[model samples]
Target: MEFFSKLLFLHEVASSHGKGLDELLIYVHLLMASLFVGWLAFFVIAVFKHRRSVNPKADYVGARSHFSTYAEIGVAAIEGLLLLGFAVPLWAKSVDKFPEEKDATVIQIMGQQFAWNAHYAGPDGKWGKQDVKFASSTNPFGLDSGDAGAKDDITCLREKFLIPVGKEVICKISSMDVIHCFKLPRMRVTQDAIPGMSIPVHFKPTKVGDYTITCAQLCGNLHSTMRGEFKVVEQAEFDKWFAEKAKAGGGGGFE
Candidate 1:
């Protein structure tokens, strides 16, 4: 199963919740394959057994046995179990079990036509005031220069963001223009970035490495270029990186 998953290009599990998603995907594929093979076998048997040279009698009442009905009921039961027992619970956990802000590394992501603008609240742990009127090519976050919290804020373009491994990281996602999707395959995280709405998604990176961040939605002609990097590191390394950015004035402008 692991080999097949890798062969299918599934990303390695790098989060606590990622294994559950991987298992669910593998189970779904297994169920689908079983159904396909079962149907193919039945079709082949019917073709050979009911051929003219064999059972020439065409019975008016076809398939008098209750096996097909039982099979259909069984399939429905399995589907219901997969939905209620797995899918629904996973969704509820992802949407409702959000970590506390104080305990999580919080960041903001704003999506434009073909780029992701990432913002960190710095040591203050409070987001700065933003207004669309202040938006510019250089200042995509629209941060108000007069706001005190805005001074220490860090902003990065094209999705170069960092998070500490083994810590809960929450991202508040929004869009400046059309709808976009933020996808981190290794973390099993995907959320839509909608304009005028800020949606939160959280995950815990179990490994320290670079992960690909891609826009799963086609927002514009340049949507294919909407790619970013997510680097997971140790807590001390993450702190060092943040300190360096802070010392450099914390993403004062586009870079």
Candidate 2:
């Protein structure tokens, strides 16, 4: 059953909201298909019945039946219902119902020219102070070394972002250079990472696996190469991985 579901979706369904998003997409496409077929059938019937030999002359008043008018009104009503019923509510759930910081795994994603930097507030649960002056190739995040909160901060470069499954991940996204769009297709999550502004994007991973994070915007020449790996693992494995990164001084390099 699970295999069949995977085949139907094609992409891996890892986020808690993935099923709802997929249902919405399916419903929209089905509506479009139904409308297309109905219009095509109507066109073919009109062409056959209104041929030059059949009608002999053009009727300015056309088919006096109000059926086409009723059909157009019906289609409008269905579209209005879809917007009010599904689209609005889904948008509210994603934007208004954000998870609390204390209850969620919060991290920072800083976008640079050709790379993504993932910053995790280590065991202390506090982020280090950062400054533009301190920014460098090796220290892309510009951690203030003197700050005690920064001692255990983990910065993962080369796009190895790891999170535990079944937990809410609240990512604070920002850009160091130009604008970039942080996109995770399977999760149905996409947000703009604007320079000098931090935006929060939240999602709960429902499965343990690997996924890809790609920039959906055209930033620069290397935008195509601005891809990253996202790994969802068990809680224990995530803890161990974070611990090791912290112990190793928590500064990753670009590939």
Candidate 3:
């Protein structure tokens, strides 16, 4: 009952991007379960029927049947097709760049050894100029000074990312140190935040709630503690919260 409840909850919570993937996942699970049941039944029946005591003259053939060979081929083909047709596409959609849309909220995600630093693009929508050589307590991103767009940006190492529900959010992710993955299971998203590269994941929360963002990759000693969350709120409330954070002073890198 508990497992079924979780599955149902997942289905309900993930109606948008997760529905199709979940259906395909269920189909694959059912197929595998059926195969397991059939194998178990066949093996049990064979063992009982061909017992040494019951059939002292039983044929000791070790070779499998032609049907088994064809079954193996069929299973392989199905797995290949499912991976190529379903999983690959879902994965691509999750990590690919967000579509160009006006007024889209841009969030920068910086992954470090044991924390996630989330930064907003601010009102400019374009990151202020940065000098890569400038590295210190004040300039963590090593912004290239010549790139004039990065100056007024606000950044925060906030424990939770707050965004408006129903608004399209594009998260641009990068890593400061080693490779780390941004994983949001309920959102049907997981992508590597690699050093020197930015990956984007776009989504609009259908419901307002707090969702976890966990590091999927093992990076360091405290990798397990590297976690974060985001709150999906109404547009007006989100704007207020964003403003408060900005007023408090934000910190992180932008490009």
* Best candidate (score: lDDT): 1
Each model's TM-score, in the order given? 0.94, 0.91, 0.79
Deviation of model 3 at 35, angstroms:
2.2
Q: What is the Å distance of residue 174 in model 2 from its true position? A: 1.2
Give lDDT tens digits, candidate 1, residues 112-140. 88888789988777788889898876787
Q: What overall lDDT goes with each candidate model?
A: 0.86, 0.83, 0.71
CA displacement after TM-score superposition, residue 80 of candidate 1 (Å): 1.7
Over 1-255, each residue of candidate 2 has an lDDT whose tens digit, in order, gives: 345445456476679887777766666766788999999999999899889998897899878889999999999998888888988898788666999999899989888778777999888888888887877777777788877788888888765878999999999998888999999887878899998899999999988888888898999999999987889999999999999988887544411
Candidates sorted on lDDT, descending: 1, 2, 3
For candidate 3, lDDT tens digit of each residue in 1-255? 336436546534432566656766776776688789978997998899889898888577865679778878888888887888887887677435455656567877878877877777665666765444674334555555455455445676636778787777788888878999998777777789998888877876678888888899999999999888888888999888876765554334333
For candidate 1, give the lDDT. Answer: 0.86
Which scores better on lDDT, 1 or 3? 1
Clash pairs, candidate 2, are: none
What is the model-wide C-alpha lDDT for candidate 3?
0.71
Strongest candidate by TM-score: 1
Off by over 4 Å in 1: 55-57
What's every prediction's RMSD, in angstroms? 1.8, 2.7, 3.9
